[model samples]
Target chain A: MTTAGSPLVGSSGRGRVGRRRARNRERLVSAAAELMAEAGVEGVTVSAITERADLGAGTFYNYFQSRDGIVDAVVAGAVETLGQRLDALTQGMADAAEIYSSSLRHLMRTAVTDPLWGRLVVRLGIAHDQLIATLGPRARRDLLIGVDSGRFQVPDVDIATAITFGALLSAIHAHLGSDQASDPSGVFAESLLRMVGIPAEEATEITQRPLPPLPSLEEARVILGGDAEG
Target chain B: MTTAGSPLVGSSGRGRVGRRRARNRERLVSAAAELMAEAGVEGVTVSAITERADLGAGTFYNYFQSRDGIVDAVVAGAVETLGQRLDALTQGMADAAEIYSSSLRHLMRTAVTDPLWGRLVVRLGIAHDQLIATLGPRARRDLLIGVDSGRFQVPDVDIATAITFGALLSAIHAHLGSDQASDPSGVFAESLLRMVGIPAEEATEITQRPLPPLPSLEEARVILGGDAEG
Candidate 1:
């Protein structure tokens, strides 16, 4: 296991060292997220992260260029996680109300459970122009596909998508910020469906049930187009 | 007429002096808004506002206690003006869709024409939750009356009103923030109507035309009950 003159080699050497490095990086990221959640993004610092991770200052630098880099990483990770969750939740919903209600619930639950991440996402999504530009198109495309297929009654797909999403996020922000007693997600979803012209009775029925399955990939392709399919 | 030793104790004297003070305060607010529009709120300063108003530092303090006070005044003034405009625009709307569309369009036009005020409203609105709490309920009650009278199909009037209003504001923010090619007001109004489950085609038609007159105050009370009417 020990070699003095020879260079460290193969599985026992480079592989083990690489694994250690990856673990260290993972630890740093986790520590950063935890710190941010507890103390807010503004309160987190390099020294605090290092202290939380039980790593030295030099080790922290080895993984991240700066605190901003860590924040970027955290945001990216959170976005990826949210995208995956949404995909899973919306995999096969035929009814527009069902899809909207389910997605709204999922999003609201995520925001409530992980409020710091939610706030960060909303702040980055709305307040930061560049981030919105980068993410808006993809989000719009997903929403339009849902609307175009009669799953939703939205006339102006793009505008409806933006407004609905923004309202949901804002409602979440308000709910989390206040001590008001109500299921914000339920209220948000119910209200949004109502605004889109879904009948009151129908909105209640859809929101009360579990969301239906999304279309198969083939059906999704037909609706979303070949480019979106890929 | 010029008063010598004793001030003229007449209506004209007090009215003239009051008008002068109001004019000076108006000029100061206009100057502050201009500076904020050019530079962001963070960049605006008392000295810059005074300079823009062509007033001395002492005069600036005479009207505003500090930069925060001036900002608050500006925000309050803008909200009041917008609220009045909304009241006028939606005064005669019997149909909820028509009311929502007209009100949304009016708000969007105001936001686009005076982006600085829009930014300030959004910032202050979010930062100070009390602002919306004070304004939102009354506007919501008016819309709810239409719902109760069978003009709209909202199940939960309060939640629907919140989502509709919230969506309208968000849509305007998105349109103004992006390079998207569409009339922000038209698109926002259309989207808002669609969200409530109104068929897109019908939404388009309703939004394009003027709305009918709302019920009288007594009639609204009979329909929505005293709690909602109040």
Candidate 2:
């Protein structure tokens, strides 16, 4: 309802419109995120998102060009933000192998505690470029650090990164599906650490070390710099 | 159409009806598999299956009770059949590590040679239980063999199995996504062998050894001894 130059509409009207637009976009993103958690990335459609948001089909187009647009927005907001937070969370660590092990342990722990988050990422599968783009480089960076310091034996960094990413999803999926009483974070991280050429015993020891907590969203925002919004 | 107690319909009618049912079901499986490969497991639906099968919506129910039913049939058919064939192909191998490596290499090579097969399994994602059920036990069995032989250092068999399954999908996803001219089979197997506790140089050598051909369908049937239908 705001016009650039109108006799009747004033600056306050533009401010109200801007706030409404932001709120509506947030609604769409939330709806998409929830739907993706329930029904993988491919399951999220524009009509479904608009319906979930209680907005008109036309409103969806105004906010997002397509399903992919909204998916990227969701992944960027959630997964990428978490990636940055994990990055910020581990920056003070000195050990290359611990950095990698700690990051993986935290990822599995997060998935175990938050089933919705785990399902969304697991459902995104391997072809999900946004998910990979967020997590891949960070994983690669951690592995390279391990390799450079001679703390881990990573013969192929790209292959190792791909395995780490995939194994995380699979382990989360396995834990979610199974009813066995097991500490997944420790074992999963241990397996991956070994995969990267850490001996089994040392990998186990590294993963067993007290895990530092992830920063709260507010703390992560301040620590990572700038608005966390993608 | 034939009725169980219809004298006039006879055995020929029953035979014709059975053949027709088999043909219709095959159409549905092929349709569902194609849709799954294109749209992922969550994307395949009853209407989509029927439409792609060139059958009426009601006809879909005549064969499969729901989308899950048809999806299971598709996964069991394509994926499980491959698993059995893999079993038949490697039954006589002396080295447990070679058995494991050869199987993984074949899987990667199949995916590389056949993109559709690769996409269908990857799109199935991590949560598809039937996919896991078919592949999990075999991976576990291979790991157990390695463990029992004292050739591989597997601290936890279950976790290693999960990693192997996840890494296969992830590596295939990586190879399909990238244009990298890397031998995914050797590198992937090498990484996994290292992960399971083989030393780097030795793991590299094992993966580099000769790989025998997988059994053809006819050969697999004779070798496996039974109808391969799940």
Candidate 3:
């Protein structure tokens, strides 16, 4: 019952109620993400997400509108979150090569650090329209930036974007398959930089350069605002 | 049907019977390949294969052991055939860069010339075991050859193999998605060559070199022996 005096719906306890709601929503999203990674997009359903989150089925409606709603939440929290961070990280960087390399290195490192997130993106496959829609523009933007600056000798920005998208997912799969590998992110970034026409020596050096950290989720929520409300 | 003089079961018509069986098996495999390309590995079925081939239900058992048997036949006809041809084409090549570029160019061209095959491979995704098993080792071998010959500057071969496997499929998906792009094969192969550490100028020249034609299916059957027997 959403009574006027009930704490959840009551204005008197609004701050605590909002925190609890957000926490439940985050739990639901994380649960859906885990299931999607283990299986694929088809594996996620409302019952599955709610059960995984250990929340009552009735509570699901309080946050998400449907199975697909939670799915988008998961994407926003994973792919979009990272994309926003990459955007923020590269915003002021002058070297387009470094900008591209940093974004990719962070992506490769995700498989090592946040494996569930990594596996989820890899599971979506390249053809998943939402996945393509989210990452494609960011990839194109980065490549085009490099092309505009004459830092990259790309044959076609579209082809290079496709190459980056494909290479990133496959490389993540390979990294997850093998537990022990030496500095995969560096190797991956170096190879991609070279593909975009950076000299081998310079690509190596740029990938070796220290990468700035992604902003914390709190900062991202503030920066990204509506894009990551879930 | 089992009468002593029935042509299909009679000894005197053995040659024609064998030819008919081979043709039927080819038809079944082709049907399965087309379905697999349009849907995915899980999309194939005995009935579906027979239905697509316009053959009677009874005829399916005469050719394949099971649904999986025909799927294997499809892989044998597609991925393995291409792998064998690449092996043949690169047998005496002195430049590892050209060998790599030529093999990639042909793979890219498959998307343009025979799109169904390309779609099937891309649909299989990077995590597909059979696709990886068939293509991964060849990619690793090519990279290692380049590395050992001092012709490439790969940071690590395993990462590069993953990149190639991922890049090839993703690039094919990209090429198939866009119908009017100019010489995607050359663009893809050229970028890959650069990724493996060839300089921009030389990578362009290598990709532009005249690529040898893949051996005919009959010749591939002779050369690859059991690998191409679908």
Taken in order, the candidates have interface RMSDs of 3.3, 1.3, 1.0
State how far residue A52 of model 2 sits from its true place (Å). Answer: 5.5
Superior candidate under DockQ, 2 versus 3: 3
> Chain A structural similarity (TM-score) per candidate?
0.71, 0.86, 0.87
DockQ for all candidate structures vs. native: 0.29, 0.59, 0.65
Error of 2 at A75 (Å): 1.9
Candidate 2 ranges beyond 4 A from true positions: A1-28, A45-67, A221-230, B1-28, B42-67, B226-230
Of 1 and 2, which scores higher on TM-score?
Answer: 2
lDDT (Cα, tens digit) per residue for candidate 3, span B161-207: 99898888988888788764466999888888989888888888888
Tell me the TM-score of each prediction against the true structure: 0.70, 0.82, 0.85
Where does the lowest 10-residue lDDT sum fall in candidate 1 chain B?
B1-10
Candidate 1: tens digits of C-alpha lDDT, residues A46-84: 999899889988898888899988776665555543444
Highest-DockQ candidate: 3
The predicted structure with the larger DockQ, 1 or 2, is: 2
For candidate 1, the chain B TM-score comes to 0.70
Q: Which candidate has the highest TM-score of all?
A: 3
User: Compared with the true structure, what per-residue lDDT tens digits does model 2 show for residues A25-134?
Assistant: 87888788889988877677889989998999889988777888888777766676677668878888899888898899988887777777787788887778878888
What's the lDDT for candidate 3? 0.79
If the candidates were sorted by their DockQ against the true structure, best first, what order would they fall in?
3, 2, 1
